[model samples]
Target: MAKVGGVVAAGFLGLSGLIWFVNLPYPMIRRPVAGIAPMLLLPSYLSMDRNYREAIAHVEQADQLVNQATSAADIGLGAEKVKLAQENLDQLPVWFLGYEPVRMCHFMGCSWNFTFDEFSRARAQVGRMNARIFQENNALTQLQTAETDLQKAKQAYQTATNVSQQQNAIADWQTALDQLTVLPRETLAGTTGATKYRNYERDFNRVVGSVAGSNQTQTMIAAAQQFAALATQNSQKSAYTVTEWQQIETLWSNAIDRLQKVDSTDPDYLAAQSYLADYTQKLGVVKTRLETEEKSTLAIAEAKRQTQELISSLPSKPNPDERNRLISRLQGIIDQLKQVQPNTTVYAEAQTLLKQAQSKLSQL
Candidate 1:
């Protein structure tokens, strides 16, 4: 029983020693492992030192090839180097030493090629955007300038027309005055005769003599007629003479009222006021006509606003016709851009966009 007990005790001690040995922390030689499971393969790798040195040499050669390919400007030559280096990496043993740099070089070369192409595409897009903005800005400027010039020209044309009308009115007044002067005083005073008829004739002669040409001669003629009519009524010594006097006073009041609205500082305003005053004296009609003509006045204002809007919408830098043509071309380019496919190499789409933009600019 004692010998059996001794054998059992030794067996238990041997089992504990085997377990401790299997779980021991051991350092790896080439492919280092943190735990015991991989430590058993350490010796085999250490014994393959000759194969390991050859793998290191291949890795170093691949590194040199990657550097050469990166520096080369010739696309074909650089691509060839990258291919060669990749072939070397593929041929290397799975467990070769210094394997990571070889793998990294392969991926980096592929990635560098992709990034270069992408950058080129992005830069091309930026150029296209700049060009489009420039064309639109230039066109807008031209349209605005042209519109302003047109407005000034229209104003000048109207002013010239008004001046011509005033001259014509003055000529008509001179003709009226000549006819009145030849008429007998009794013929002008039909209903009643006045000794003051000669005084009205004298006043007309005085105004006609002071005239700086015949510009306001028509107005003076009308005023003379009103004065002569009043004299005829006064010959009867009737109250109707007061009414004729009031009518002549009202005509003068309307002329002065319109003249007061004119801004003397503005050249055009001065011309307009002068024209209004001349018409008032010649016709004595606007006081009754102005209220009825308000609608036409509003229409003119609306027309002016519409003209301004038309000019605003027109391109500024280019002529209107040219801008319309450019806009159509720009639309075509935008359609082309949409149809263009994203490229894997150079900026093919961006290049096409740039070409279209340049073509449109040439047309402009």
Candidate 2:
């Protein structure tokens, strides 16, 4: 019975020692993907699932590539590799954060955490991430600059009052659109930025079309205004020859034609219509004045011609009757010229001729 009791005591002690050994806290060589149960069952800490270790190992490989890079051109390739490593780390499940004992914390202070080496390897990719961010920032800046230029062009186009100005601004807008590829990709900055630029492009084209219509109308209005000014100048003249009246007709007609060409949709179309009515009325006034002037001009020319012939035909003898007859004829010519009015352009010349004839009569 004593020997049997001794064997039983030894067996109990051995079982306790085995349990302690299996449950002992061990240091992590690599982070494991397996659950706590498997970590407890496996003899080696790294022997179960090792997906976390593989992901972290990718980060280390990327770091090696980054270290080999010497120039700015090589940095792009290195950043891509680093992004791959980041993708792997992102794929890791949340449960992969592991718990283990290290040399500093033997029994109670230990907790679930990333392995020190794995965390450092993942942290090493931060520089590469920063590089990619900087590249994106530069691209975004260029895009914004180009976008601002496009905005100015669009504004100029919308506000321009003439065809030439609108055309120049539209050309600038086209150039800006051509350079749209300089913008950073949506993957780099975001979809929002790219979407904003696209909206600008759509709005710009719409505004340009409106501007083209407006400018076309403005161009026609300008052309009409030039003709209208000339018509006004000619209409203000107190005297018009038959040829001058014909020229006035041409100017008024051309001005009306241009005004008629103004689009009905134009903002100034109603004003143009009103101008057409006003010009038509003025043209009638000018035509009436021209007819009166033409009749008066013909009468004045006949009287002057008859007076000059009589003055030339006067005898060398200073007979009172002959002199009186010549003076009466000269008075008739002056009376005809007085009807021409001082406001008339030919009236001044007529007055000079009247003064010369009166001097001849006074000498006789």
Candidate 3:
């Protein structure tokens, strides 16, 4: 009885040892299939044989990985590499998520050629490409530096709560990040630049947008009208210096440029168009007035020069009729100059000319 029991125990122990030995390489065998995963290249599946939640979840996971791959491709990882990686990752058994591996063991099955060794080689190929990006694109380093600058600016903005300081900090952050464009190549920078600019633009516009708000249309209209009013008033009075007139025109021009940028999608697009037309019309009137003022000034100058010549060539003996004509011409020039508003530079010239002409006439 003891000998039979000993033999049975030895058989049981040997079987257990054999089982452990067989399973020892299981972990190693499972790696490549799991590692390359949905990212590994596989034939397109007509149906993954998964329930709705599980299927959708797998797709979402694949999408995220593919998007990252696309970003990686921009830095020189070929698109095909990313596509193959995604294919490997998107399969079952390896990424079964829930269903039994045996159930999915159709077509190419899980453990056949899709083992850890192949996955490792594929992953290594991809990993090598990803690591190569930092080497090939020197701008990748510059991009990182710009990002650090943006972070610093953000910190400064946070520390300074004042609106002005915040605006400055935001502007600095944007400028620093914009420097990335010159450094980073388009392959990598295109997507990143767009994303970074979009984010910074949003932050930059926070104060601006809040201030503009729903009343953008109303505010634009009011500002335009006010600018028109000021310009028209100055032009009508002819009371502006050349420099002053130029400044007014510049202000109006800047306003128009801003109005043109009003988004077509804005609710007030039609209103903006109407206001733009009206402002343009007003600007035309102002331009016309400026031309008229300039022509009038030339006429006055001509009249003054002719009168001065006439006065200098006057007869020493009385030529009452000719003297009367010269005085009358000078008087006309003075009147023309005075007709412009008190603010007109021509008005001051007019006063001086009038005094001289009057004194001359009295002496004659």
Best by TM-score: 2
Work out the TM-score per prediction.
0.16, 0.34, 0.33
**Better by TM-score, candidate 3 or 1:** 3
Tens-digit lDDT track for model 2 on 1-364? Answer: 9999999999988967654565444333223312334433333333223434655565566555554544434456656666766665554433334444243234423222466565565656555555654665565566667778788888887799998897899877756654563464533333335666678666764676766556646655676788889988877756667678778877887778878867788898998898889878877876776666676677668767887797688788858887788778777776776666554456677778778767866775
Between candidates 2 and 3, name the one with more favorable TM-score: 2
Candidate 3 accuracy as TM-score: 0.33
Highest lDDT model number: 2
Q: Which ten residues in a row have the lowest lDDT in candidate 3?
A: 38-47
Model 3 bad stretches (over 4 Å): 1-238, 318-364
**Model 2, residue 65: displacement in angstroms?**
90
Regions of candidate 1 where Cα sits further than 4 Å from its true position: 1-114, 161-364
lDDT of each: 0.41, 0.63, 0.56
Give per-residue CA lDDT, model 3, range 1-364, as digits (tens): 9999999999989967654443332335333443444322132121333322343343344334433445544444343444445454444334333322333355446443244564455456555554544443555566667778877887887797798886677666655655654553334544566577667656645744643333445555666667666766666554666566676676677557657856787777787788778777766765655665566566557757767777687677757787787667666755655554444467577667768767765765
Any runs in candidate 2 off by more than 4 Å, and if so which? 1-219, 230-249, 261-268, 281-300, 318-328, 358-364
Query: What is the Å distance of residue 3 in model 2 from its true position?
Result: 99
- Better by lDDT, candidate 3 or 2: 2
Model 2 scores worst on lDDT over the 10 consecutive residues at 27-36
